[model samples]
Structure formats: structure tokens, C-alpha cells
Target: MTGFPGVRPRRLRALPALRDMVAETSVEARRLILPVFVGEGFTEPRPIASMPGVVQHTLDSLKRTAAEAAGAGLAGVMVFGLPETKDATGSQALAEDGVLTTALREVRAEVGDDCLVMSDVCLDEFTDHGHCGVLTESGVVDNDATLELYGEMAVLHAEAGAHVVGPSGMMDGQVGVIRSALDRAGHHDTVILAYAAKYASAFYGPFREAVNSSLQGDRRTYQQDNRNLRDALREIRLDVEEGADIIMVKPALAYLDVIAAARAICDVPIAAYNISGEYAMVEAAAANGWIDRDGAIDETLTSIRRAGADSILTYWALEYARRGATR
Candidate 1:
């Protein structure tokens, strides 16, 4: 054979320094957001069986962890609360003394602008039925009514010192309602992180346990179908139009294409969740000697960034940050 017609690219990949210099995508600790689950009425951290190395943090543990996150230079920490009591309407969600609201205040105070303090604005963790919103007399989730509660919840989170509020319930017009609520409440600077194309995926199994879910049926009625790309883009566009500061796609690994697609038509920053099941699978495999944990973790995060996610919500954010992301 003879002279090649194209340039040889292996030279660029010949050394780590060469590869780093030419790398098109990089994962940084500052672009990774750690998702934290804070439990009410617990004196000690409880390990989550489904998620290895993750735990339900008590209030004290939660503040310590938030400080750790800030010290690690993480982009932010997202808070999910586990309440001791539940109800049909999830009244605790709006209570000033509620678990989540309290955690938000503590976390924000602990971090103190060092890292963003974000809160999950949904009723699932607080509702008795385990649905994301209140149900009708017929036992179906009321979309319009849910929007009203979401509006209130967003304001509460903002008032509690949340820099960003994520509405993951997938209720129609949720972003708009929450935006209006925040503006009216005089918290106009609070950012709205829309769970724009959150798919109703089975990968959420571990997450259900993490939050002690009381899901009655399923969220397919509200969460987007995994089979439809058009549906994802539609939701993303609508959220952007409705004042979503940043739009997100859930279950990042399986929906990298959707994440890339969302980036294509979006003018705002894009975020993707490296959800629980994805984390568990890798952890399980590593425990069983199936894969290198750090390697898998780095690859998983890098792939999301490569797919155009401006930031990633992940269980491994702190671990990855501590070990140093592949930057």
C-alpha cells in the first residue's frame, strides 16, 4: 500500500498531554451538581440499599455534606426531602417548617454563595399517594390543580434560600406557573430548572426507594414517553418559552441522543441527569469485579458532556470531584 490520502490522527492520541490539548469535551467538578437526599427526624445517616455509598442524610449530616460539596468546588447541590408525615394534598410541601424548606435554608446558609443550593419542587416525596401532585375524586392526578401547587412550592423554595428550583413533576405549564409565582412573590432572581424532557423510564427504580416513594400507579401519564424524540423536543421548547432558565433531560445515559437534540434547538443551558439506576448498575458491576468504578464514572459523565449537556446532575458528583474529573 502506499501514501495515505488523509491525515493520520493517531499522532494526536499518542500521548495523554496531546489528547488533553485536543480534547473537545471535558468534565469539570464545577459543572457537576450533586443530588442530596435529606431525611426528616433522623439523627444519623441511613444508607440507601439500592444505591451503594449513598445515604439518607439527617439534617446535621446534610449540612456537613453541603459544606463538603462547596469545599469540593461542585457546581451545586440539589436537595430532595423525606418527610415524616404525608397527606392527600402534601401540605408539608408548602409549610415553612417542612423538611425540604428547612433543608433549603440550612443548605443555603451553609454554602453561602460558595455553591448553588437547589431544591426539587414536586409533591411526590411529601404526598401520601406517592404521586407528583394531588389527585381528583376519580383518583387521577389533576394537572391544572397540580400547577397551582407547583407555583406555591416554587415560591416557598425560593423564599427558603434556594438559588434554583427544579420542577420535576412534568405538569403542563409548570414552568410558567412557577415563574409567575416567583415573580409575584418578589423572588424574581430565583432560577427555574425545568425537567423539560423527563421520561417515564424504569431506570428510576432506585430513586423511588431513595425517596420512599408512595407512587400509586405510574407517571407515564405525565412524564414523556421514552420512545418519542419529538415529544422530548416539544417539551423542551415549551419550557424555554415558559421561562425555563435551564432545560433538562432525564436518565442521561439512555437519552444522550435526546439530550443532544434538546441542545440543537435550545438557546439556554442544557442539563442531564445521570439517574439512580445508571449509578447503581455501575456500582454493582464494580462491586462484582465487572468494571472499574472510576473509569466508568468518568466515561459516563464525559459522554453526557460530549452530548452537549452544559451541566450534569449525578450521584457521583462529589466522588468524581474529589477524585478529580477528567479535565
Candidate 2:
């Protein structure tokens, strides 16, 4: 076994300045993207119990937050909508004046190219059944039909001034459909950040509550299963071939290997989501005095960045960035 010889590695780790100088990965505000939730018709922001410290913002609050995020020098903000109504077809998702669309326009106006404006191009929040797509008569998610809706959603988001439209439904051919739709709609400059490796993980529990999900069944059929890493790579390749400008791996902490693998094979930028459940667990443990909260937050994000994520979507994005991310 080889050692550091005369240049002992232990000495390098002896001081904070040396540690900072030798850091292999950098986690900066420019690489952090905040995930924000906005709902229709609210006087003030509403707290989500499942995800403590996360709130569903009113339009006013959302715009203010967007300005603040820009000021914090964040990479961007990803918007998820909590619609006032739901339907089988998720019609509100395509509404010109819907919660998500309105939020996109307003956020873009507030930030004005200062930061990227991303929107979730999925039906889970708008659909009555809480599935990612419309169901067939036999109750199976219609993959092809769902692709059409995703295309519509992406086009709408692009038109509303989204810098990026993230298709997270995990439906086959979703990226192709969205790309075609956007091209037809003359949104050539819009970026598609495909959720190519989203898994059906237990980590999504807090997210369900955050979105007010009415899911009657599991998403195991469409979402990538936890057991399949090969499938994730395949999906990433497929999404890239289908015109994805960037690709994402959801609930990033548990899938660092996946992120690393994705970076190995992906030419486009790779994004990883630090999901709601992951955030909640840390908060809960911190509240119980089980860990140094700030240290944990810093470590959690650093690990993800080290694993090869070009960008990270985290609930702590705003807080961490505003605090200068000094660890």
C-alpha cells in the first residue's frame, strides 16, 4: 500500500485553509436551484406539515421569493403548482392562466434573465387521480396518451417564459413528444431538463403531501423501480437521444452512484433532486439534536455535488445560497 510519503496527507487535513484549498468539489450558489410551490388563490404562504420549513406560496409571495432567489445568486427556481382543481385530463395544466403558467410569467418578469426559471411539466399535481398521466378504461396509465399531454404542458411552460421545462412523468417517449411540441410552437430556445432517472422511491412521501396528491394507487408501473440501475441509464440515453438539453436524477442522496454513472455517460448537464422526504428526515433528526444541522446540510449538498451533479435542486437552495454556503 502506498502512503503520502514525505508529503503526508494528514498534514493537508490539519487546517481549514488547507482543507478548503484541497477540496475536490465546489458547491456554489450558481449550482443550486430552489424548488418552489405556488398554489392558486392564497392570501399568504401556507406551510406544508410533511415538509417542515417548506411552504406553498401565494403569487405575491412567490414573486417576492423569486426576486430574493435571484438576489441570493441561485442558479434557478423550479416551480411546482398546487392547482385549485383537478380533473382526469389535468386541463388546468394547459390553461393559459393556470397557477403554474401565471407563476412562470411572473417569476420571469421578476428575475428578468437574472436566473433560470424552470417549471414542472407533469400532470401529477393537476390530475384528479394523482397519477402522472391519464388512465385508460382499465385504469392503466396510458403512456402514449400521456405523452401528448406532456407535450402540451411543455409547450405551455415554454410559452409562459420558462427557461427550462422539466418533464418528470417518466412516461416513455415523453421527451420526444415535448421536443416536437416545443419546436412546432417556435420555442426553439427553451431548454428541456428531462427527469430521466426518477425512481419510485419511499423518499417521495413528503412530496405527495406537499403537492396535495390524491393518488389512489402506486406509480410503480411507470416510475423506475429501485432495483433497476441499468434501466435508469437506458432511460437517460433515450431521453438524450430524444432531445433533452439536460437530465436529472430524483431524490439524489440515495442515488449518488446513479448520478455518478449518469455523469460518466451523459454529455449534457446532470441535475439531481434533493427531494422533500430527504429534507424532512434531516430536519426531523436535527430537531432531535441528532446532528449538527448546518454541518449536515453542507455535507449533504457537498456529497451530491461530488457525486457528479452539475446542478442540484434542493429545498435548502435558498437558505444555503443566502448564507454564502460557507462550511
Best by lDDT: 1
- Where's the lowest-lDDT run of ten residues in candidate 2? 1-10
Q: What TM-score does model 1 achieve against the real structure? A: 0.98
| Tens-digit per-residue lDDT, 166-249, candidate 1 | 999999999999999999999989999999999999999999999999888898889999899998899999999999999999
List the RMSD of every prediction in angstroms.
Answer: 1.4, 1.8
83: Cα error in model 1, Å: 0.3
Each model's C-alpha lDDT?
0.94, 0.93
Candidate 1 runs further than 4 Å off: 1-6, 325-327
| lDDT score for residue 206 of model 1 | 96
TM-score leader: 1
Residues 1-327 of candidate 2 have per-residue lDDT tens digits of 567475667888999999989989988999999999998998889999988899999999999998999998999999999999999989899999999999999999999899999999999999999999999999999999999989988988888899999999999999999999999999988999999999999999988988889898899999998888999999999999999999999979999999999999999999999999889999999999999998899999999999999999999999999787454
lDDT of 2: 0.93
